[model samples]
Target chain A: MPSLKDVKTKIGGVKKTSQITKAMNMVAAAKLRGAQSKMEAFRPYAEQFHAAMASLSAGTGGARFPLMEVREVKKVELVVVTSDRGLCGSFNANILKVANRAVAELEAAGKKVSLVCVGKKARNFFRKSGKMRKDYIDIMGTFQMFNARAIAQDAAANFLSGEADEVRLIYGRFHSVALQRPEQTTILPIKPIEGEAGGAAAPASQAVYIYEPSQEEIMEVLLPMFLNVMVYHSMLEVSASEHAARMTAMDNATRACKDIINNLTLIYNKTRQAGITSELMDIVGGAEALKG
Target chain B: MAALIQLEIVTPKGAVLSEQVEMVTAPGYAGVFGVLANHAPLLSTIKIGNLVYKKDGRDDIVMVSGGFCEVSNNKVTFLVESAERGSDIDVDRALRAKERAEKRLAEAMAQKEKIDRVRAEAALQRALARLKAAGKM
Candidate 1:
């Protein structure tokens, strides 16, 4: 049993902790709004890019694009994105779980797997596993588009160089503060839609466009741009998701701390009352003895 | 028929412009090209240059870094790596950026480093595009 003084000290410490947690919660909440809006603003551009790519791939002429070439998977590169910090509950764990499962599945199928970790949490997790081939630790905190571009360029170069046969991105998809889903998406060899009329079947009603430059040259330039944009959008999504997860986690933590402080305060009060009553009882007994 | 054509300009950050327009002029990789309503389905690579559109008889300009353009179903879309509207371009800042890129390009050339030269050239091109869109070039 703790003494009254000890209990009082514990209560004071808990109160201080609760206050700090509350402050952290408020700060996370403030950051969350900005991150969420940034994510929302970028959604339309990503969606339209995907739509345009889908439509183009559906056309007959898409066969001419080298990126449309589907090859046998031999080696795979996994681009895993996680939070730089670990205070957010389960966000990093969820992404790592998905990535681990993917790696296991790929290895089981007799394929070589490499990891390109984007954040400190991912780097640490994969480094412990002894599986990460490329780790980008410096660029995780800033979450800039140029950083994403550089990473995407590196991955694309590796794929084009035949260092990796396929490239996949594993990330946490942000839906809401209450919902984050881990997803794995294939990034390379751009999958073509099945049963779509080829681009050669241009609508007869539409006028024929004369290409000033060759079509082949246009595709060569566009493919890299598409890859860079996709990577940048993914980074944005992951950043927003991290902020949302942190906000929710900190809020819950602050509430929990408050509850603990309240319970400790109650214990401290009870202990103090017991100490005062025992002292009073001793004084009255001593006075009665003296009267006797 | 001259039906209004849908034009959308998008960058990695987000969609910057999405509206119906009378016409659009883009800096194609080969040269500048103009598009009208009912234009045939086409896909072309774009260069770092000015993009102009006429909407409700008002001319609007945008600076676009190199990317791709696609037209289908009377909708024209520009998937640029980066884009900034002319109205949003700060003249002083753009001038500074241009000078910086020029200096970097000269230094890279002097050092005889192809990679750095190429990067500096791209920066220069982006700055030039902004200036062109702002009507300062």
Candidate 2:
């Protein structure tokens, strides 16, 4: 058993720790709200963009740009998004796990793999691995539109330049406050998304239309723009998921801290009671001995 | 009566407007054009100019930047780079921008370094459009 002083000091330390964790949890909660709202605002644009991509390219089988070409898989580029900060539960680790497995899988299939990391965590994770094509770090907390554009340009250039035969983006998908799942999406080839009603009907409607600018010109700008949107969308997801994961982790930490503080208080009280009883017994026994 | 067209104006930020309207007139890539209900499946690039729409017997104005417009099945969607409705535009800000743009244009002639002519021109156009939308032009 620790001395009363020691136990008292420990309780003070734990209370301070709990206060810090509680504050962190509150901060994370506030940030999560902002991030979640930002993500919510971006969802319609993504869905509309995908819908428009499907409908616009419906006229043709698919655009004939190099972006739409499916070549033999010789090299694969993975655009990996992770959180810039740690203490976000397993969010960044999950991303790293999925990304590492993907790289290994690609390599096992007799393909060369390169990485384009989007966050500090990803950059740090893959630092020892000599497979990074680009690492845009510290862009997760304070995100910018041009960051997405810059990333999209790099990915498109790699695909067009034949450095990468296929390009895939791996990131945490923000489902809810309690859940963020790591997901992978293939970005290159700009294929028409299936199960969408408008995409399939595009081919039939291509014949009887007046395209203001020619069909090919629109495809030239739209495909790359679509790629940029995808990158932007992924970054937005990372932001929201990071905040949510941090909030949950901090909340758990706070709860654990509370538990520890409770247990410590209980122990301190018992030790105090034991010390008081021992002192009273010693005084009573001494008085009785004096009387005898 | 023709079915109303569901017009949506979306920028990278988010959807600016989504409504069922009777008519829409936008500055297209080639020129300004108007669309009613049952327009054919058409796609056109939007130019930086004023977008005019009529709904509930009132005409409203929006300043739109470069983007694309698609019309299909009574739904007209304008995927724009940026947009601001007339009511949302700050008249003072627009006027200030106009003054700044004009000042820069004048300063460009006397400066030794080459001025970004395109940027200044775009700024001027955007300010003009905003002022027009706010009914201060």
Candidate 3:
């Protein structure tokens, strides 16, 4: 039987842990709100930009730009984005898993693969992978559009310089608090986003558009801007997903702690009752012996 | 009364404004252009400058950084990197940014630094736009 003192100490430790988890949960919740709002606000801009790109590409009718040029896939660069801190249950792990799967698939196809890790977690995870082209650390907390621009520029440079034939960005996409999944998109050699309705309907709508300073010139600037926007958008999604994952993980931990404390308390009470019952039995026997 | 066209200015940060206006004037890549209600559909790249719209027979300005403007279906939508309403701009801060950018540009010129010069020029443009939007320039 465990002693009361040991039970008491165990309960105290679990309680402290629960307290910490609760605090973390609250902090994550607060941060999630800010990140979520930022993501939501950016959605309109991204959507409009996409619509514009779709129409422009449709109207231009095969206008060739360097960024939109599809090249042979001899070598691939993966920009894996993950959170800097760990403790969010499986958030970073899931992203790394997807990225690793991608790398494996690429390598299996006789293509060379390189990595550009965007956060501390990815950097640490892929530091010894020998395929690391570059790693950006300690930038997730207060990352801005400029950070994304820098990363995009690096990827573009590598692609243009023939160091890599293709560049892909992999990050967690935040759908909701309960749903964050790893997703990958090609950032270099920009693919014009077709309208969701269908490709057939896109061209008809493009006919009425008038371009300013010619479609070719507009595309020269738009494609690079598109690349930058994609990186920034993905970064925003990852930020929101990180907070949501942490919040959910901490909440689960707190609930589990409560269950543990309850179980420990039940055991403790049973032990105490057993000790009292044995003492009563001993007293009764002593009285009986004295009377006899 | 002039026909009112829907005008919306959006940035990566958020949607700054959506209102019915009599006319919209934006700084296009080629030059400044104006659109009224029922204007033909057009897409154009815009530069860092003031975007003025007339609402209630009064002029309201928005400081827009580089992005795109689309006019369609009697609506004008601006997708800018950053935007500030004329009323929302802090003139003093804009002035400070202008001075800082000017100093950096001068230093870069003296040192013959290409990269810093470009960045300083961009910053200077943004500050000037803000100041212009606020009618301080």
Predicted chain B of candidate 1, TM-score versus the true chain B: 0.94
Q: Could you give the CAPRI-style class of model 3?
A: medium
Q: What would the TM-scores of all predictions be?
A: 0.87, 0.84, 0.93
Which residue window of length 10 is worst by lDDT in model 1 chain A? A202-211
How accurate locally is residue B137 in candidate 3, as Cα lDDT from 0 to 100? 69
Clashes of 2: 1
* Candidate order (lDDT): 3, 2, 1
Decide which is better by TM-score, 2 or 3. Answer: 3
DockQ for all models: 0.48, 0.46, 0.79
Give the residue spans of candidate 3 off by over 4 A: A141-143, A196-208
Q: Write the per-residue lDDT of candidate 2 for residues A107-190, one digit (tens) a residue.
A: 999999999999999999998899998999888766566688789988999999999988999999999989999999999966
For each candidate in turn, the interface RMSD (Å) is: 2.5, 1.6, 0.8
Pairs clashing within candidate 2:
A58-A202
Task: Flag regions of model 2 displaced more than 4 Å.
Answer: A108-110, A141-144, A195-208, B1-5, B20-22, B54-59, B90-137
Model 1: per-residue Cα lDDT over A170-245, one tens digit each = 9888888778778899988766533335544534422364444655565566567677777776776777788778
Clashing pairs in 3: none
Give the deviation of candidate 2 from the true structure as CA RMSD: 4.0
